[model samples]
Target chain A: MGKRVGLEVTVAVAEAVALCRIDMAGVYPITPQSHIAEHLSNLVADGKLDAEFVTVESEHSAMSAVIGAAAAGARVYTATSSQGLMLMHELLPIASAMRLPITMAIANRAVSGPLNILNDHSDIMPQRDAGWIAVFAENGQEAVDLSIAAFKIAEHKDVMLPVSVNIDGFQLTHMVEPVIMPSQEEVDAFLPPFVPHATLHPSRPVTMGAFSMSDYFTEIMKAKDEAIKNSKKVILEVWDDWGRQFGRNYKPVETYLAEDADILMLTMGSMGETAKIAIDELRGKGVKAGLIKLRLWRPFPFAELAAVLKNAAQLIVTDRAVSFGGPGGPVFSEIKSALFAQANRPAIYNYIIGLGGRDVAVSDFVGMFETVRADKAKAKADTYEFWGVRE
Target chain B: MNIVENFDLFAPRLINKKELFSCGHRACSGCAEVLSVRLMCKALGDNTVVASATGCMEIVSSMFPTTAWRIPWIHVAFENAAAVASGVEAGLKALRKKGKIDDRYIKVVGMAGDGGTMDIGIQALSGAMERGHDMIYVCFDNEAYMNTGIQRSSGTPMGASTTTAPAGKASSGQKTWKKNMPEIMVAHEIPYVATVCPSYPLDFIRKFEKARSIEGPSYIHCFSVCPTGWRSPSETAVSMGRLAVETGVFPLFEVENGHYRMSADMPKKLKPLRSYFKPQGRFRHLTDAEIDAIQERVTAEFNKLTQKAKFL
Candidate 1:
């Protein structure tokens, strides 16, 4: 058993990385994500972590450096947020296409234009098509666990793809919670030393990141799509193994009072925990309000989502980021597409909440459930509303 | 160092027989850039990893299913070669330390074109050098964005007409002087920085070998003659590089630990700038007054460099 200590989520994540024994970390500091980078660098400086802490100039270089390091057969890590994640957007797909097993932690925050640095899903929404395996954490414990599991999932021979473990910015990252810091022995058992599939070495020369013209671009993209789609099996296997060892079983889509419910509320990231409380409050009022928390964002748990949402008559889907001039919210649009062909699809309503870290309290979620119940007769599924917008 | 001493300009037998960069690359017929890359590969030998940028070299050498590189090479993107090389060096160091890989010294080399090095890639290059990674970054300066088109880049010399900075009734070619990338690298206080051209193969090879021998970061700016982009005859590629040197437009020199040393046997009196410019059609539109102004600027820059060397 590992020791349970009250530590900041970012510090716990850093400790988790230390336990994984990564070979190198190329990092740059950005708001809400700076603590993770600082702690990692401090670990290297104090000799607690035997790794190269490359303080790259920008998030672009951080991503580039880790791609290079991972290509050179090193287990590499990095972290960023908001504008930094935007900066790294260019290389994210390149890393995935090269099939380098690089792990990164994204402190989910709002991107600029209003220049806000707070909790939101705006940072990671743009990276949906970057071909990386993305997971969301609801609390400190999941943050640490998912971060450590990220390396295993990434370096798995069957799934040599990069992963991004997204933790809600200041909401989850800055909060201190009692987390079980897994021992090095446990992590070592879970993740063996990385055996790279192909490396940049003189003895075995291979060209990586070659330019693909129209001759082979479509086939290469199809291969990448298939690779990510097939990685779901390994993700489940790793999660099952982690559950067997750590006593905390995790699923792609977790539920609360969801079985046989007529109304369901859906959320991702730290808001899931708050929505759970709302579910409890709604159940007390004799409204069969269930909750669905999406944990896996990439290689999205489509089957699991459909299964959980089978019996629900209505669903209140909450989104932290909006898709301008297109559909309601990014997640809302994807869920609508995922369930478009189903025979008994639930009436879905999207409520874009928590723009730039406006607190989405328990009462707010209960209000959404009540509103959905009241408007059940005339529920317009195509439109979305901003929850707390003053205008 | 002794390997450089044995290098004879005329004797082909003295050069290493191993060709790390194989022939049959898709580089244009007389591409001096590819030749420079080939010589650099020979100098570095087999124990090297190359992180290339997205440019003519990467596209030509590494088309899918057909690679001309015998040494391990990677092309990540256009502007991150230096950063990638830093990661490669650090990765190798960590692997060797952890006994994950054998404890043998492997050199990390970064290659980029002028647009990759001086324009979009300058920040990454500066960061890598400032961090003092044990790597070599060679910027192949053809003075324009040759891979995309003959677009103007920061390395484009004055009075040189590129597609973007075309000489017209209103404009006089490139408005600004060529960016002094070698001097900018020297400002990083890196251990070594050099300028080489394939026209002087022995000098180029010697400098690459010396760069490999250094323990910290080294930057080499090679003068690559682009015949198609420059609108010059394909056969004049080698002579174009020679003319660049003879006219002091691109001098062969080295800066080691802040000490400058011009290459031995440099012309005491530089040839006229017009002799160097006459062959290329890019500069054909330049008026005599424009050529004279460019000449004056080139002479002043050369004098400044020589004066620095004298003090050293």
Candidate 2:
């Protein structure tokens, strides 16, 4: 990693493309994602990757471009953020429902309200149902690594759903890191050419996304449901295979100091680093606290979450997006539902933190633990709170 | 209506127990949407998937988990029927190349109401046309947004009373004329474009068959008369639709590769527009001047269409 100094993040993204052996990259210009596209476009232009890079007008078109490319028997890729991601909001579910092995990178940002744009997970929370395998990365190294792994996982014969590699807006997207760039020869040896089980070839055409009357309605959804549920094993196999090749363990949810710990905090994206610090600090102060970094979101990692949280006395979830009119943030609701059937789950809390690029500091985590204790004692035990905003 | 053998039902071409658009819908008596759907299914057969938008037809057929479609079907959100169909078409195209699917039987078709077609879905519709995917789009024009209530849409004809375009002192009903969606679609210069009425089943089926046979983008602006939306009895949903064509209010025509052909030749002895509008409460408030204006406009439009079709 140290020997690979003085390299640009854009080059790292291109190296990811080679590692994944992306067939078609459909992209539009929006912050952060543009560099990935630009580099890929240059590579395709120079005939390095031997792939198709379609430059679309909008994110809506970007996603549609990939939909077309993917359906046409291509391992499709794309990248967008914020407004661009929102523009593609409508097509996301269509991609998943149609079951295309499409992979995309989301340079996460806050949605526009007062016209502010910066790094956050708010751009992606509202789109949980779009049926993509969504994962958050803490650094550029993970972005490069996950992008390669995503192609393998999404293109797995059992799982034909889309996958998204999420990185914080400018934080990880533009940040320089010691990314282990694998050569194209090594990548070719590692990842095989994408052989789509269902393509839109004229020689033999089959109807997809057909009109399903009452008879096959449940079955159609059941197919997707089963695909997503069964994707767990494929995810594990891909992760293990990738880790073996790349020498990094990117589990669904990795535990830190949780073997004998209590009061565990669950986090995702770049915020995991902050939560890790809070865990170390609390342990230093003799508090039996730990951290769980949620590397995978879609396919929810429910079993792993339950196994980690069932023993803990108190569980806390920190989310970057504010899901209005609901029970706090998006993570809170999903966590509750995942544990709903579990026998006597622990006292859990949902906290909205780092919204609209607001910093989620170490003191905020410390304050959150104290608030959890005080609120539970006072019998005013709400399941969630905002970390950075005023009441 | 007795069941007759040797009816030449196109059911042989369809896969056994494989109906793309399943029946058992609560379509109003003589609802033209039902007939149009049946004919379209015959043309598309088991090789196509339909993206039906939210409307009277979708409500009666697809209610949550239950659907009136036997083939691979989907109902993404409203106003996205075209966009989703575009995605479906692209996805199927990619998968087939990947050796994941079979041949070209998997065409994409989007079914939408007038509101979904002429207005809310226009952008998506245009985008699909511009993209040039091999697909068929059927705009079932019922004149109003019936699923929501009898509300005026861009396809609502002049002098028709809607909830919003009511017959009042301030307005003589829908003062604006129906937008020419077929012409708009033709402007996309797609491979095929047609206008068909459900009253003539053979002609409607033939038009759809032609649209489906072509390879690129095609659109069918089907005249789907809605008795509920038109403020008329359910029994008149079909006859009223036929009257619309006979009165020159709606023309049965097809335009392909920039050539126009009137599917139904206008008879020399034509019924007046009054016969078409008089039975419905929608156009009841037309004054002598308003009626004259509508009559004149219809005559002119009919003549223009006849000229184009005759020339072709």
True contacts kept of each: 0.80, 0.13
What's the residue-level lDDT of B297 in candidate 1?
94
Interface C-alpha RMSD per candidate, 1 decimal = 0.6, 5.6
Error of 2 at B266 (Å): 3.9
Query: Per-residue lDDT of A1-391 in model 1, one digit per residue for the tens?
Result: 8999999999999999999999999999998999999999889999999999999999999999999999999999999999999999999999999999999999999999799999999999999999999999999999999898899999999999999999999999999999999899999898888999889988798899887788999999999999999999999999998999998878999999999789998899999999998889888989999999999999998999999999998988899998898778998988889999998899999999998999999999999988888876745665599997999
lDDT of 2 by residue, A1-391 (tens): 2225544565686667755666566678887567888888888787677665555546776776577667657777888899899988987888898888888889888889866677788888878877789988887677777888888889888898899888887766777787677666656666777878865444444444444567777787788878888998998998898778767878999888887776778888888888788878888888888888899999899989888887777778888888788876788788888888998676778888887778778888888876775654535433677776776
Backbone clashes for every candidate come to 0, 35
RMSD of each: 1.9, 6.1
What class would a CAPRI assessor give candidate 2's docking? Answer: incorrect
lDDT of 2 at B172: 86
- lDDT scores of the candidates, listed in order: 0.93, 0.77
